[model samples]
Target: MPENGRTDTGPTAEPMIRLEQLTKRYPGQDRPAVDRLDLDVPPGEIVVLLGPSGCGKTTTMKLINRLIEPTSGTILLDGEDVTRADPDALRRRIGYAIQQTGLFPHRSVADNVATVPRMLGWDRKRVAGRVDELLTLVGLDPDTYRGRLPRQLSGGQQQRVGVARALGADPEVMLMDEPFGAIDPLTRETLQNEFLRIQSELGKTIVFVTHDIDEAVKMGDRIAIFNAGSGIEQYDTPERILTEPATPFVSEFVGSGAAIKRLTLSRVGDVPVPDWPSIGQDTHRDERAAAVRAGAREFLPLLDADRRPLGWVPADASGDVLDRGLPIVTRIGPGDSLFAALDAMLAANSSAVVVVDDAGAYRGVLDLETILSTVHTDAGPAVPRPGTVATPGTV
Candidate 1:
């Protein structure tokens, strides 16, 4: 590992982005905003520049796309020196999104999304098709939202449109500067999930900037925790940053409650799914009662004919099991993080939550006890590092 904790992938694998002694100093300023920094961002991964306010994370992002000229140093994109490339051309190849959304007030959503393709001189037919495709990709209905102005949309909607616009020409790389920071908490979370889904599909190389540690942990494949002068305190995966802080600054900046934060690193699918007693919604009363008596569970999961969970039924209850059972207000999928499973349980005030597949078919069950056990396992809370040996009792 490099002194900054950044893994060197060696000469055979060229990074999508490489910064060698990159520095940005402004006139009349005593110190440089971004001190000489060396960093590498592999292709098809999200590398987050995380730090406190004014730590130059944003500046580093801007430097990547030449939004601001660097005082001196090399900026390589796909092994080509782009430090002195045409600013406009370089930016066109890099998608950029900021906290403000930055959509044109006078333009319609479709028109805004078409900005890059239009600039690239794509014909109207192709541009229009790309706009519609991108709108739908970002969860906006083209027919309903295409003609609407930026002012007419909600904050979350505007951000979605902004993202659509950033991806206008299908750039290989994207720069996001706290894109969801201005939205409401619930909406912010929804957008974050949506973006992650999109990234999984597109696999775009991304450099995301944020001061929020939780956001960094959730979004980044690797995080560069910056201190003042753009110094990288720790450049490693979120699991390592939380489990093994490189410096006192990183430990303090990561803050307390690391055990809880580690939960985000694991997904529901990573844990063993426990089988729970279940009954079909249409089972006869006698049959249901007999099955309940046969099992030791107090409550049995109720499933529809299609095998999707409906609710939980008290095993001893009489009459129709479906009508008397408690409704399942929340259901999670394999892709959801264990943190999300825990949240679902807490939000529904239940000790267990239903797990489903992509088609919403019943998979198994995740209970509070399983989550606790996973957290307190001998292997330590989070997943083991790539090459590290686990202890004898470790999971």
Candidate 2:
């Protein structure tokens, strides 16, 4: 396997997976575990189903893979109805990882990963190659770990093997139930960070279930907070869930630390763009010199014919417009969280990066100072007056 493909192109509207008024009821339970749940998991996104215990989050996830059939409604994958898709066929195409790391006790790690391919009737050599490739992809050394049985490995290592096994068939959609939950706190965080990095590269459409709000906030591209019989309380960015909770239940569930959590969600878009001066790319050298003499800053932002951001060019790099060429640009999408904007900035090694629409064209540079101010602003206090007296402990 060459690892999952990456798309650096702009966002696409096609929903990789969709649930339309999906409902699930168990025999003994009086209420539906998941009630009329409607959600869309856009291509290459991580959507977290978050809630407290017995909130129907797990049920919602299981329904997608058809491990538990829905009582009513439809489930669509890539716009095709999968409500009645064959269980074995559906299961093979959708990767699944649970908190238990359900490895077969009798099998070696390599053989375990080869389970699906073997079931699909792949020959010995292809299965072996796939097992080795998957193991390496999940950060496990194939040579050392491949021959070991599940019992011979540590819990974290076992979990890694479980992840490798799920990805064995190169499934487009992944269903994970607290894949990092059972580990110790430090190990959990390490796994979470590693998963984030992995996801960035793999671009799999992931549906993750978790009871931990912090984990949901940290891991999700968008989060759906459920309220059991009450249905979905909120489905939005982690930042929106923190900054503007949909209900009291959401606020209480997200808890007292939301303001600080907002730091992780708030990005360059939260702040207003400044009215900084700029010139067209075709300006003459005499005009450019005059603009510089008149206090034009270095590294001016460039724009296309539509006033869409292209990138920035250094003032000293070239005096001629044609010589500047197309400016190198990096940007965060409008749908991205503040944290993503920060990551973009750091990756670009610039204090600011361009913000763009769902399409790849530029919006504007979201500077670091703008981000910091949004994070540090008081929760309820009005902007401070120059002569006002300060309260004892309020902003």
Candidate 3:
């Protein structure tokens, strides 16, 4: 709760990155790009710098890596004073990814990802292994993409390569400046989710820069909302920022859709999944029909022998259920956000979405009503209905 927005990580644990009175001034500029600002980034947590253009959010991030030298201030990395450290050596310890991807057009994907490792004097075998490891880590197949140039890949692929390159040496800290900004919305969302999944495994200390509020909400463990002159208007969790605006600028910037934005904070797993009428694929035609009729549901969810959803069969379907009705095209996992669940429902034009586990096993069904009830209520776990047991996978 400190004004500087330092996360409380106990007395013994120091911040991974700390900026004290950080200031940067450009030549011929009347005002400093970054004023005397202070912030702290805890280990293994993402701290987002969010603001409008020219608000100095990017400048503050650049100053940390010495991409833009601070005119006056202190930069500390893992309790070491690195303000005057060798820029090259300092950068090698911190990964950097930017909006444009910045991959060499002629360089093969493997070579691009191996940049830092090669520079650090890693042997061919070591560098090669690292390249393949990171490429796979970022969802690119090393065997296929190793020899392909940046131009050979799609925009999303290029961005993935860029990320792989940034993580070339397995740095403990990563600085991402609008890394997904240039991609299309769908691809951007995918990359965001992928990166978040990666972060969960790697647990790297990250400084993420973005002008988009929704991205900040989704990606940031803590967001530092900046104003002109690099002044931090508010620094808090996304839930706090949305529910309790510290200032008028914060309120206006968050806009009037705060309720809708809160959906990003709750994951599908956190909500109670209600039981729906389901029939196994092996069921006989007469039994299936009887079950659907007795259940009185409009659609019957058909599950394979492994309890994995195959599709939904309409109530009036005849003969083989597998041959009829709509395929389960859109599905959500427990890790997905409620907003994503809602999106899946709308995209599939269905009233409910099939919930699957990590192994694609059927968990339960999430309907529109459950989502709305969560939104209007206190955001706690929903009450399980009578006769329905609430397992880890269900309400």
Candidate 4:
């Protein structure tokens, strides 16, 4: 594997991929396609290159694998200089997926995915096993689709095959150029989500090129906005880029609704959901009476034996227990975007949404006021239940 390790990155302590003073100019062109570009892609992170057409984003990507030779500069993968390495060999070490997919109509899906592994001289059993494994990884049913030709699959399926093929060799880095751009919006979103789930699991160092801001925001750990000279207009997280754009060009490119885009960065886990007044299902009558009289809550959350909330008991209702205030239907988990929580609230026409853990155990209630307070200031911590109000933690 070419002694891939960086002392700075533990045993592998340097940038997974580094481009320094990279420049590319066509023979007769007045300007370089990528002029003196410099970029460092750290291991286990997705760095998105986003810009307008003709802004050198794709050129910069191609330079890394030497798909197009740089006019002058250096390419380093895992800290070893690759400027002098064989282009084809360097490329094989880096997985590349493109918008067109480039699958072979003549080849079956499994064979297409096996391309890289086969080239690497794996035994037939290993190549076949890897092909099936990769096909399954990208959500294709190997048993059903393995032998099917690429033309027989739908566009989305073809794209999946492209991704699986790219991953067949399990390369440390992936270069994806608008790989989802051709799919319909709904399918595109589904594929994007699936990619995210896969990326989170695989943690491959990736350079994703896209012209769409929303897709960049959704996919990138850090986004680099490029200019004609390959200069970075802004390089930061989606939150900083949206909330505090570095330049007018960026603000314009990010488009309107900075506030709405901010919602994407804010997760339900990060909002401050205040503790509510609650009583156990077997609480004493006097205790229940005191809770209703105190009026600290609109409804006392009723807890079961396991500390999970049953339903709301209206504070104004008579007796220890009354008719269920409302069924606990929709819930927002920690990983969900605040935008989703707000949507759930609006859909239910409720002031607050229930937050729950993965097991469906109630955590707390997130209200509009708390969400606004945190988001408007842009300083909220994740799932802060302030004021030490003694929450049951499971409701």
lDDT of each structure?
Answer: 0.84, 0.74, 0.84, 0.78
TM, every model: 0.87, 0.67, 0.84, 0.84
Model 3 lDDT tens row, 1-395: 32354544322467899999888988998988888888988888888899899898998899999999999989999999999999999999999999999999989999999999999999999999999999999999899999999999999999999999999999999999999999999899778877877887788999999999999988888899987657898888787788878888888888888877887677788898877878888887777777777885678888889988888877777765535456887878876678778888999898899988878888889999998998888644542211122122222
lDDT of 2 by residue, 1-395 (tens): 00101122214687898888888877998877777777888888888888888887888889999999999989899899989989889889899999999999999999899988898899999999999998887778999999999999988888889888888888899999999989998777656766776777688899999999888987887888877553777787676678778788889999997965665544344457554555455666566545644654555566566656554655554544434433554666654556666777788787776666655555666777777777776552222111121111111
Per-residue error at 360 for model 2, in Å?
31
With candidate 4 superimposed using the best TM-score fit, by how many Å does residue 39's alpha carbon deviate from the native? 0.7
**Any idea what lDDT model 4 has?**
0.78
Off by over 4 Å in 1: 1-5, 8-12, 280-296, 315-323, 378-395
For model 1, residues 116-138, the per-residue Cα lDDT tens digits are 99999999999999999999999
Kindly report the root-mean-square deviation of model 1 from the true structure over all alpha carbons.
5.6
Highest-scoring model, TM-score: 1
Give per-residue lDDT, candidate 3, residue 158.
98
lDDT of 1 at 102: 90
TM-score of 3: 0.84
lDDT of 2 at 161: 91
Candidate 4 per-residue lDDT, tens place, 223-287, comes to 88876566777777677678777778888889997777677666677666797666776876566
Clashes of each: 0, 2, 0, 9
Candidate 2 overall lDDT versus native: 0.74
